[model samples]
Target: MNAPKLRWVLFTAAVTFLIAVLLTSFFKEIRKVDTLAATLDKRMEELVGEERKTQKLKQDISYYSTPEGISRLATEQFNLVRSGDRIYKIEVTSQDNLQ
Candidate 1:
């Protein structure tokens, strides 16, 4: 083959290989970006869930700071009652005890 023709062929092959390598690298980078985006979306969803939990906790704090909520909690947790409140007691026997 002529020298010019051979050089032209070699240049073309080199360019084609370079393009293939670049395209492969670009695709790899694109795949990495897609994976990172998916991970970011998952993290964002987790953050939103945590934010909701935080909001609910804030609401609970607000409610528990109120007098009515404090009274309910006191009654439920400590079995406390106001003045003049009546208390009742009941007893039951199990089947084995009855037998």
Candidate 2:
């Protein structure tokens, strides 16, 4: 083969090898970015759930501050009776009997 032709072939082969190496590294970087995006998505969903829970707790706090809610809590927690109200007491022998 002529010297010029041999040099051209060698140059083409070297360029092809360089391109292949660059493409391999590029694809590896893309895979890493995809994994990071998936992890970020999971964390974003968790944050959304926590925000919803926080909003629900805030609403409950607002409700519990109302007079009706306070009265209900008092009756349930302290077994409070209104004026002239009769209270009934039941005796149970065993847990199964109560059920």
Candidate 3:
């Protein structure tokens, strides 16, 4: 064919090849972006769950730090009696005596 025509054909083919390469790279970058976004969403969900647990634990700590709660815990858990309340002790002289 003519030189001018051949040059035009080569230029068109080169442009088409470049376009294809650019499209392929663009698609690969899009997939990477999608993967990154999904990962960020998953991490955000985990952070939200962790934040909720932290808030719940803080609330529990605040609840237990109250005077009434402390007193109740001391009374029931430690068997602490109020002031002037009497407690009796019973002792068995021998383990087999009652039997």
Candidate 4:
């Protein structure tokens, strides 16, 4: 073959190899970016769930700081009642007790 023709063939082969290598590298980088994006989406969902829990806790804290909420907690937890409230009690006996 002529010298010029041989040089041209060599240059074309080199360029093709270089392009193949670059495309492979770029495909790997694209896959890594996609994986990172999926991970970020999952982490964002977890953050949103935690934020909701924090908001609920804040609401509970604010309610418990009020007089009405305090009164309800005292009544339910301690069975204590305010003045001017009436109390009633009932007793039941089973058939076995009579026997």
The lDDT leader among the candidates is 4
Residue-level lDDT of model 1, residues 1-99, one tens digit each, is 646788899999999999999999999999999999999999999999999999999998999999988988898899999889888878887899766
Give TM per candidate: 0.77, 0.71, 0.68, 0.72
- Native-referenced Cα lDDT, model 4: 0.94
lDDT of 1: 0.94
**Candidates, ranked, TM-score:** 1, 4, 2, 3
Q: Per the 3 Å backbone cut-off, how many clashing residue pairs does candidate 2 have? A: 0
Ten consecutive residues with minimal summed lDDT in candidate 4? 1-10
Residue-by-residue lDDT tens digits, candidate 3, 17-36: 99999999999999999999
Error of 1 at 84 (Å): 5.6
lDDT of each: 0.94, 0.92, 0.92, 0.94
**Higher-TM-score candidate of 1 and 4:** 1
Kindly report which residue pairs in candidate 4 clash with one another. none
Q: Tens digit of lDDT per residue, candidate 2, span 4-89?
A: 78889999999999999999999999999999999999999999999999999999889889997787787889999677878899
